[model samples]
Target: MSLPNDASEDRMQMMTKTERFSKLFDELERCREDEQMQKMEEMNGLIDEMNEEELKSIFTIELFDKIHQIIEEKTLPLENALVLLKHVGYYRELKIIYLESFDYSLLRERMKEMIIDENEKKEEINEKILTDLCECYALLGEDDIFGEVLSIIVPCLLKVALKKDETEEAQKEVEMALLALGNIGYWVEKESYGNEIKEIIKYHQEHQNLTRLAYQSAWEFLIKRFHNYESLEEVFVNDLHFAREARREIEELKRDVDWKRKEETGKEAKELLIFRKWIYNIDNYFTSCKLWNEEVEKLLSSFVQMIREFRDNSKKVSNWCFFSITNAAENRNVKIDDLLKSGAVDAFSEEMKQSTLEDKIVYDCLYFFLNVSRRLNEKKDDEKKEAKRKSIKRKMFEWIEEGYEDVMTSFHAILPDLAEKSKFLQLSKYSSDYLWSL
Candidate 1:
C-alpha cells in the first residue's frame, strides 16, 4: 500500500486506540457518503453489537497500546495526544492510571523540580499544563478536582503575575486568574466559601486593578451571603476606597469621550462632592479656622439664596431648607431656636412642615439631629441630668405603651384568652436579663 502523506502518517503514528475507534467511525460515515453502503453496513453492524461501555473498554486498551508504540517511536506530540485523548474521554482516565502506576513521592519530587526552576519558560509551561488540567476536571463535573487544581495554580499564578519582571503575558495570566476566581465564587455558595474567597481577594488587594476587581467581587459576595450589612471596617473601607476612586476616574474618562459626557460629568461631580462631605464630615466636626469658616459660610449662604430664589419664583418648596438648621445644630452646638433667631435657619422649619415625615432627606435630618442631641446629652451637668431623667422616664413610658399596643393589635384574634393570661403572665427571668443587657 502507498504510504499516507506526512501529516496523516504522523497522526496515525500518535493515534491511541480511542482515537482510532473515533477515526473508524468518521471513516465509515465518509464511506457511506461516497455510496459505499456495503462496507458502511458492515461497520455499523459491528458498532451496534457493542454497547458504549464495551466500546470504551476497547478504545482504552487500544489507546494505551498506541501510546506505548508512540513512546517507543518517540513520535508523539504531547499536546496533540492529550487533546485526542480528551476528545475520546480517555485523557482523564489515563492521568489517573499513570499517577497510580507511579511512585507518587518520585513524581512529586519531579514536579517540585519543574516548579522551582528559575527559568520563566519552564514555569509558564508548567502553569499552562496545570491550567489545562483544571479546565478539564472542571468541565467533567469534578469539583473537588477543580478546587484542588485551583488551590495549587492560584498561588503560582499570583506569584508569576505579581513579579516585577513579568511580561504582559503574565498580566494576561493574572486576568485569567481573576476570571477563574470569579467562576469559583459563582459555583460555590457564598456562605459556605465566602471567607476563603475573601482571603484571596485580600491578598489581591495589593494590586490596584486586582483590588478593584476584588472589592467588586466582595460586594456581590457579601450581598449574596449576608442579608444585612452595617459598616465596613475602617481599614477595609480605606483600602477599598482607592479601588473605588480608580473605578470612578476610569468611568469619568470613558464618559468624557461618550455622548453622555455632560450628564455623567455632572453625576461624577455630585458623587465626588458627596464623598468629600462624607470624608471630611465638615458639618459634623466643625474644625475650620475663622477665615476658612467664613468662606464656607459665605459659599453656603450664596447657594441657599439661589435655591430660595428658584423656589420662590417657581412657588415650589425647597427640600434642603432644613439642612441648614441641622448643620447649625451640629456645628454650632446651638438649639433650633437659637439658629432661627440668628437667621441661619430661615424658612427651614416652614419648608420641613410642608414635607412628608417619611421623606429620606427628612430621615437624614432626624438622624443628624439625633447625633447632635446625643453629643449634647453627653455634656450634661448634674442638674441637667436630673431634669433629663424625668424626660427619659416619660419617653420610656410612651415606648412601653406603643409596644403594648402593637402586641395587642397583632394578637387581637386571641383577645379573650390573651386577656385571661395577661394578668397571670410575668416577664421571664431570661427576658428581663436580655432586656437589661440591651
Candidate 2:
C-alpha cells in the first residue's frame, strides 16, 4: 500500500469508509420522515378500517427502528428524540429495544430530558405534567424512577403550596404530588427521600388553603406507607386527626398486608410477623383515636373466621387499649364523653374490663370515669324525656364518681405521693361552656 498507493486506490478507501458510516445515517433520517408521513396516512386510512389499536402498534415498531438508528447516528436534537419516545406505549417498547441494543446512551439522554423538562415547567404551570410524571413514576415502580421523580416533585409541590397566590387547583395538585411522594418514599422504602417528603407534607398541611387536602393526604400516606411504624401508636395517641384517618387506612391496608409482606419478606417467616406488629400498633392506635369500637368489631369478625388457634394476646391488647385512651385524654383536652357519644366508645369498657389490668388498663378505667362525669354534666332536662334522661344521667354520675374514687384509691395505694404529682394536676376542669355550645 505504501509502495504504490494510487489516486484510485486512495479514493476507493475513503469512499468505502464514508459510505459505511454516512449511508446508514442518511437512511435513518429518511426513514424518520417516512415514518411520520406513514403515521398521518394511517390516521387518514382509519376513517375506513378504523383499527386504532392496530395503527398504534404498527407505528410503534416502525418508529422505534428509525429513532434507534437516529440515536446511534446522533443526527437529531435530544428533545426531538424524546418526542418519539412519548407516543402511546412507546416508552416501554423503547425500554426493551434499548436493552437489546446495549446502547444506554439514549436512556441516559432521556433521563436528562426528564430533568430538563421538569426544571423548565417547574417555574410555570406544572400541575398536569407533575401529575402525569407521578403516575408514570408510580406505575414504573422502579426505585430509580421513583427516587428521581420524588426528589424533584416534592420540592416543587412544596414551593407551589407555599406560594401566597396559589390557587385551589394548585393546592389540589400539590396534594396529589405529596401523595405520590408518600407512595414512593414509604411503599418503595426510599428512606433517603422519606424525610424530605414528610417535610413537604408538613409544609403543605401548614398552608391555609391546602390544610384540609394536606390532612387527607397525610392520613392516606401514613396508612399506605408507614402503617407499621414502631411509633405509630405514639403518633396516633398524640395526633387526633392522624388517629381518626388512620382507622380508615388500616382497614384498607389489612387486605394487602399479607401479600405485601410475602413480596417484601420471603423465607424469613412464612406468614407476616409484621401483621401482628401492625395489629399491636393498630390496636393501640385505634384506642387512642377512639376507633376501637369499629376496629375491635372487625377483629372479632376476623377471629371468628379463625377459631381454636388463637394467639392469646388479650393481655397485650387490653394494656394497649387502657393506656392509649387514658394518655390521649390526659395529655390532650379530649373528652372521653365526646368519644363515647360519637359511638367510638361503644363496647370499649366491656372489652377493657375483660382484658388484663396493666398500666394501660388502668388508663382505660380512668377514661371510663371521665366519660361518666361528662355525661352527668350534660344531662338534659327536657320535659318529655326528663325522667328517662335524668335516670340515665344519675346512674352514670353515681357509677362514674364511685369509679373515679376507686381509681384514686388504687393510685394512692400504688404511689402514695400520687396526689403531689403534676400528672393529676394536669386534668382539665369540665368545660360546661364548651358543652353548652354543642
Best by lDDT: 2
Off by over 4 Å in 2: 1-311, 314-356, 379-388, 394-409, 412-438
- For 173-208, candidate 2 gives per-residue lDDT tens digits of 555444444334344442434454455445544654
The number of residue pairs in model 1 that clash at the backbone is: 2
lDDT of 2: 0.40
Writing each residue's lDDT as its tens digit, candidate 1 over 1-438 gives 556687786886596544545565444323423343443344343433333444445544344445435534445433333333333222222111222211122322332333334223663465565553333222222232234434554454434334333356654444444433332333443334444445545555554444333333333333322222223222223433322433353344323333233244432222222222222222222222122222334434433453364354322213343443345555443332333233333333233344334333333333333443344344346887656644543443333322433322333343344334445422221212111111
Candidate 1 pairs with clashing backbones: 17-62, 17-63
Best by TM-score: 2
Give candidate 1 misplaced runs (Cα > 4 Å): 1-125, 135-150, 185-235, 246-250, 256-438
Q: In model 2, what lDDT does residue 101 have?
A: 23
Note the clash tally of each candidate: 2, 2
